[model samples]
Target: MQVVIGKAITYEQQRLIKIVQKQLSEIDKQHLKELYEVTRIKHEPKDFSINEVKREIECGKDIQSLFQLANTILPQLKISNESIKYYASLVGYYSVYKLK
Candidate 1:
């Protein structure tokens, strides 16, 4: 997930990005930073929308905090119930995997 940072992000999107970055490991942050630079050079749309940010956070490895974040932000995003269920399942799968 490379964010292009093409345009000025809204305050909500910025907040979501900060939360995602906070949840990321140092290694993942470094990797994403490199990807961000490359995507910016390629002129790709790396700028994360609020929804995209929510999706990324939903799929993050840190299950507990990520799930909590999702619960907190999804409603704010006004995402559909189906999308919420999808993310919940993804979180459940990852959480189980981590327990193995």
Candidate 2:
């Protein structure tokens, strides 16, 4: 029996996709003990900036939804959900620098 299945990634999922991409940029500068290139995520666009992800979060988006989104995007990239949220939270922490 062959069954075709596709996952419905939501708006929050899209936001997490952006968050994961932004987080990767900062982590890329650090010395990773593991070769993260093997863990690189492809579908999320590089153009989605931290500020953009922040906008999504600031627009009354819930954290639980964001976490669910994170699960979908980062699993393929081999990143854990906790690590994903920790990095995404930095978007709020470092938001001042993002303001021009």
- The 0-to-1 C-alpha lDDT of every candidate, in the order given, reads 0.50, 0.47
Q: For residues 68-97, write the lDDT of model 2, one tens digit per residue.
A: 544555666565779768866655455323
lDDT of 1 by residue, 8-65 (tens): 3465567766766666677555544343222222222346898666655554533344
Estimated TM-score for each candidate: 0.27, 0.26
C-alpha lDDT of candidate 1 relative to the true structure: 0.50
All predictions: root-mean-square deviation over Cα? 16.6, 17.2
Residue 42 lDDT in candidate 2:
15
Model 1, stretches more than 4 Å misplaced? 1-62, 87-100
Pairs that collide, model 1: 3-46, 4-46, 4-47, 5-47
Q: How many clashes show up per model?
A: 4, 0
Kindly state the number of residue pairs that clash in model 1.
4
- Alpha carbon lDDT of residue 80, candidate 1? 75
